[model samples]
Target: MKYGYYPGCSLERNASAYHESAMEVAAALNLEFAEVEDWNCCGATEYMAIDMLPAFALISRNLALAAEQMGNGRQQQLVAPCSACFLNLSKTDRYLRDSPELADKVNQALAAGGLHYKPGSLRVRHLLDILVTDVGFNAVAEKVTKPLYNLRLAPYYGCLVVRPVRKTPFDNPEYPTSLDTLMRTLGAKVVDYPLKAQCCGGHMTQIKEHTALEIIRRLLKNAADYQADAIVTLCPMCQLNLDAYQDNVNKHFGTNYNIPILYFTQLVGLAFGISPKKLGFGKEFVDAAPALKKIGAEPPPKAKKPRPSKTALPMPAPAEED
Candidate 1:
């Protein structure tokens, strides 16, 4: 199937692995993605909170371009691999369709750039939704040359994608199982992770270090408790938070967790027999090789580290009120 692609800013830089692996997996599945021309940022997770009109305008610009690019095509779907991008795009389209006043203002802003987007002209879908729903698990299973046998994965949805309860959500928002089902289709063991839809404290790691670390620590602890070999996520922000600041979380919480945070597409590529190097495997902060080795082999028993008693450690000092 052919669809318009929006890689978002994160995919071009910190989350390049997601883009690379997604491309390889797309090739394996005979999917065609034509990138939208001159696409801009999606205002990320906080831009809308800072300023509503500008944020919607910024997001709507991409929508306008996508609609123009896929004019009258059988498939007018624009796929975004980043969770924030998907939400921003989808939310903007939904809001514009519901609020004519807001759409008029956004279009007035777009008029300056010679672009106007009619709401609902194009369908915005997260990459995972398209992969699982459109491509179908059976088609994906047939393409897996190296099934991820024996690999235990905690599918982390990270509070986005299947959220805000859209009119036709592809998965359950409160407790999603699409990612879990996808991993199982690849022959991997899916852990029953309750915190799968919890927030990863997006951008909060920089705003509130202590609070963010605690959030990150809880997720790591839960996944570790389930004996998951790795935490596979669908969002770039979640992967960045849990993988980049993991050391800080460990130091602050007095925990010795060593769980690897990976993108779901990476495992999908691996299952399709793609080389790790080509899949952007080494870009992650945590080394995925150790967890990946568990596939098709009897991994040596993990060494248990003595965790410090929570009661013994002093609670983090409260943040001073402004």
Candidate 2:
């Protein structure tokens, strides 16, 4: 199956391993991905709230690129790895293409850039959608070389993946279980954490540290309470907020709840039988090595303990021989 990919900015830096594991897993599943040429940012959470048109236009710009650049203006559906980008890109494309007033306003802005987005020209899909609907869980199950039989995971939807009433079509806005289903396909024990779709407080980590930390703390505490080995996610912001800021959250709350926040792609990599080393398990700020080991996934076998330096004991032995 071929998918036109729009990786967004996070994939290039903070989430490079996501791209790596995604591509490798896609290859394993025979998924053909063609990335949009010279794509731009999706305007994330902040841009949309402040300036609606330009924000949508920014996301639309990438969608327009996806339609225009992918063979003589032929519309092509884009597969987005980040849930925020997926929702933003999909929402803007859908709303603009549907509402004439909005489209005219956006097109007026587009006049300067020589870009116009035609409605229904693009289909924005999240990585999870592609994994289940396109690739099929059974196919994913077939590729499992090492099933994660014992590990329990808390599926964190964050805020962006499912909400705002009407955008994505996968599952319930308040509670999403597709990720849990995918994890279960890999033989993981998925938990029913009611806070799955709760906000991780996003960039509020910068502007409102206390709020972000509180939110992050709750998610981690709940996951740990549910006996989760880690948290599985579909957004870079979610992964970054949860993974990178975990220590800070602990400091703020004066609690030590350590749980690895893993990307859905990394789990897919494990299901596709990729080694844990290539999956970037050790690079995570939160130590995932322990949880990974529970899945029988180790970091290159810890390099066999070096043999005792021969010279130390050899000196006395050689003297005796002499």
TM per candidate: 0.91, 0.87
lDDT score, candidate 1, position 167: 79
Indicate which candidate wins on TM-score: 1
- Candidate 2 lDDT over residue span 77-159, tens digit each: 68999878888887887787669999888878776799877867877788887888888889888898888877778988877
RMSD of 2: 14.2
- In model 2, the Cα lDDT at residue 100 comes to 91
For model 2, the superposed segments whose C-alpha errors exceed 4 Å read 72-75, 164-168, 296-322
**Worst 10-residue lDDT window, candidate 2:** 313-322
lDDT of 1 by residue, 182-208 (tens): 998888888888899999999998899
lDDT leader:
1
Model 1 residue 186 distance off true place after TM-score fit, in angstroms = 0.8
